[model samples]
Target chain A: MEENEMRRVDLVVIGGSAGSFTVLLEILPKIRTDIDFAIVVVLHRKNNFTTSIADVFDQKCALPVLECEDKDRIEKGKIYFAPADYHLLIEKDSCFSLDYSEKVNFSRPAIDITFKNAADVYQSKLVGILLSGANADGAEGLAYIKQKSGTTIVQDPESAEIATMPNEALKLCKPDFIANVGEIADLINQF
Target chain B: MRIYTLVDDDDLETLLNDVANKYGYDFTEYSKASMKRRVNRLCTLDKFASFAELRYRVLNNDSYFARFVEEVTVNVTEMFRDQHFYKTLRDEIIPQLGVHSHIKIWLAGCSTGEEAYSLSILLHEANLAHKAIIYATDINPRVLETARNGIYPIHLIRGYSQNYINSGGITDFSDYYTANYDYARFVDKLREHMIFATHNLVSDSSFNEFQLILCRNVLIYFDKNLQDKVFNLFDASLENLGYLALGSKETIKFSHLERRYQQIGKEKIWRKMK
Candidate 1:
C-alpha cells in the first residue's frame, strides 16, 4: 500500500464510553453534511436511562442520526447509534443486528463486539475512531480494524476528557492518526 | 458495489435445505446474514474444512446435526430481562388478567425458562399462581431441559436479583431460589405451575391458545418473511385482547399483523385488540 494513497471507505464507526458525549458534540456538528460514508456510534450509558441519545445527536449534527433497529439497512451519509441494552452488530449483508447476547466489557452495546464485526464486513474499506472513555473496551477493537488494514484514529489523549480509552487504543494499535476533537472533525469531513 | 462472499449464500441455502430434508429441522426462513455468520462460526468451531464437509456430517450423523442445531439458535436470555416490561406486566397486564378465573400464558422461544420463571414469580406475588398455567417452549431441547431443572449459576443470580429489585419486586430476591455451592435452584413450587416443551417457531404450529404470549428476541434472527409468519402464528394462538410481550429491540410495527394489535404500556408489550 502506498503511504499517501487515500483509503476508500463505505462506513465510519466511532466508539466511546463514559465521557464521550461532549467530544461527539464538538466533532459531529462540524463534519461536512455531504460526506459519503455512513457513521455508527456506540456510547455506553446507565441501563435505566431511557432518553434517546440519537435524538440528542440529531440536534447537534448536520447529518441525520437514528437509533439502530434489528435488520436496519445501512445507507451512505447517515449516522446510526446503538440502542441502549443491545449489542449493535453489522452483518455480512451490511444491515444491522441488535444482539441481546451477554454484555462484553460489562456493557451491552460493547465497542469491541461492534468494531470486530465492522472490521469483518468492511475490512480495509472502513474507518474506526476511538474517543473519550473511562474503560479499555474499544482498544482491542480498534487494533482489530488496524490489523484489517482499515484507517484507525484515536482522540489525542490530551484532548480526551477521559484519556483511558484513547491511550489504551494508542498503545494497542499505534493507529494511523491521532487527532483532537477539531482535527478529527476536519479529517472526517475530508472523506 | 461488490459484496464479499466467504461462503456463497446459495451454497449455504442448499446446505440448510439438505439438513432440513435429512433431519426434518428447518432453517429456510431464518435471516441469511446472521445465519451465515452462525454457520461460518460452527464451521470454525468444529474445525470443518469446508461447508460441504459440514453438510455431509449433518446428513450422515444425527448427533452432529443436533450440535449444529444448538449452535445455530440464539439462546440469550435473563430472568426479568428488560425490567420495564416486567414492571409493566406486574402493574398493568397481570392486574387486568386477574379477572380471568383460569389463565394460560405461552412463552414462545422461552430459552432456559428465565422469562417463564420470572412470570411465575410475578403471579405468585400477585396471588394468582394457583390459577395460572404457563407453557414455556423452545426449539432447543437441551435448553428446555435446563429450563425444566430451574437451576442457574449463582454468579448470574446477582444480576437477576438486581433486575428483580429494579422491576418492583416486593420480596427479597433470595426467597425465590435456594443457593447451593455455585448454583441457585428455583423453588419447586414455582416450577410446578409451568410446563416446558420443545417447539420450533420456524417449523412448528401453535400447540394451544393463550391469554398471554411472549416471543422475545427470538424473531430478530428470522428474516422479515419469517417474522410475519411467526406473527400470524402468535395472532392465531393469542386469545383476543390477550397480552403479548416482545424483546425490547423487537417490533411489530412493520409486520402485516401490526394493525391487529395495540401497544400496551411500553412499546414492547402489546395487546391483540382486534
Candidate 2:
C-alpha cells in the first residue's frame, strides 16, 4: 500500500494476553493525547471486583481512559479497556455492546471477537495491533483486520515477552508492520 | 483462515420479523452484535449448511424454534456473582427490608435460579424467609424449569461457596443443598418462598409491586429504546422508595428516570425517591 493512498483511520484496537500489561505500560505514556482515532485495548485478565484496570491505565496514560460500558458511544481521542468477564463488541451505530455469552478461546473479552466486530464496523478505516501474549486468541482477529483491508501490526516475536501469541499471528497473516515496542510506539505516534 | 459468514444484518432483521410474527417473541430490538453471534453459533451447533437452511427449520419446526429461543437468550449466570453486590445486599439492603412486615423481591431474568437460591439463603439466614417471597422470572421456559428444579452442577458449588462466604454468609453454604451423583439439588425448603415463572421484559407487563427488583446484566443486551421501555416498566412496578438494581456496567444515569432514582452506595443499586 502506498503512503498517499492511506485512509484516515478512525479506530485502533489492540489485543494482548499473558505479558501485554508491561508492554502497554511502556507504550501508553508515550502516545500523544491529540490523536484523532479512538483506542480500545482488550486484554485477558481475571475478574477483580475490587479494582479496575482502566483506573490504573488512566493514571499513567495521556488520554482519558475508561472501562467500556454497555452502549457507550465511541468517541475520538479517548481510550477504552474492555471490562473483564464480558465480550465487548463494536456496534455499527458506533456504540459498545457487552455480551455475557460463552467464552471464546477459553477467554471472555476475546481479542478475535472484538477485532472481528470492530472490522465489521470500521472496515478499511481501522488499525489492529496484536502484542505479546502466550495464547492464540488474537491471531484470527489480526488476520480478519487484514482481510477487511485495515492495517495490521504484530509485535516482533523475538521482542515479545512471550512469543507464542505474535508467532501465531505471524503464521495466520502478513501484517503491515512487525516491530518491537519502541518501533510500535513510534508508528502509532506517526498516526 | 477459517472465515465463516455470519447472518447478515438484513437477514437477521428478516428472521427476527418472522419469529415475532409466528411466535410473538420479538428480538428485533436486541443488540444486533450479540444476536448475530448467538445465531451464528446456533447454525454451527445445529449443523446447518447455510443460513437459509437454519431459517427454514426455525420458521417451520416448532421444537426447533423452541431450541432457537433457548440458545439465543443469554443464560450465563452464577450464584453470588459480583460478591460485593451481594455483600451490599446482605449488609445494607436486606437489613433495611427486614423492618418491613413482608418483603417482595423480584429477580428478573433469573436464569436457572442460582441467584434466586442465593437470595433465599440470605433471607433464610436473616430469619426473614417466612415473610419474604422471591418471584424469579425469565423469558425462557426451559431455564425457568431448571430454576424450579433448583439443581446445579456440583463443580460450581465450590465457587459459589467462596462467593457466599465473601458476601457475609453466616451459615455453612453446604447446608443449603445436598450433593447427588453429579448435581447438587438445593433443599426443598428453599423453594417454599420462591416462585419461578416466564416473564418477558420486552413484551410482558409488570406483574407485581416489589420492594426490591434485580434485573442485573440483563439490560446490557437491549438497545437504548428497549432499555428505556424496560426501565419505565421497572419504574412502574416499583413502589415509592423501592430499590432497583442493575448490572455493574449498566446504569440509569442517562435515562429519563435518572432524576427520580438515587444510587445507593457505590454499588449498582438505585432507590426510588418518589
Best by TM-score: 2
Worst 10 residues of 1 chain A by lDDT: A1-10
Q: Score candidate 1 by DockQ.
A: 0.31
lDDT of each: 0.86, 0.91
Candidate 2 ranges with C-alpha deviation above 4 Å: none
Model 1, position B147: C-alpha lDDT score: 96
DockQ of each: 0.31, 0.75
lDDT of 2 by residue, B1-274 (tens): 7576558778899999999999999999999888888898888888888878988999999999989999999999999988889999988888889888989999999988999999999898888999999999999999999999999999999999999998888889999999998899999999999988899999999889999999988998888889999999999999899999888899898999999999998899999999
TM-score of chain A, model 1?
Answer: 0.96
**TM-score (0 to 1) of chain B, per candidate?**
0.95, 0.98
Between which residue pairs do clashes occur in model 2?
none
Q: Model 1: how many Å of interface RMSD?
A: 6.8
Docking class of 2: medium
How high is the lDDT of residue B82 in model 1? Answer: 77
- Fraction of native contacts in model 2? 0.68
Expressed as tens digits, the lDDT of each residue in B132-230 for candidate 1 is 999999989999988999999999999999999999999999999999999999999999899888988888897888899988998778877788889
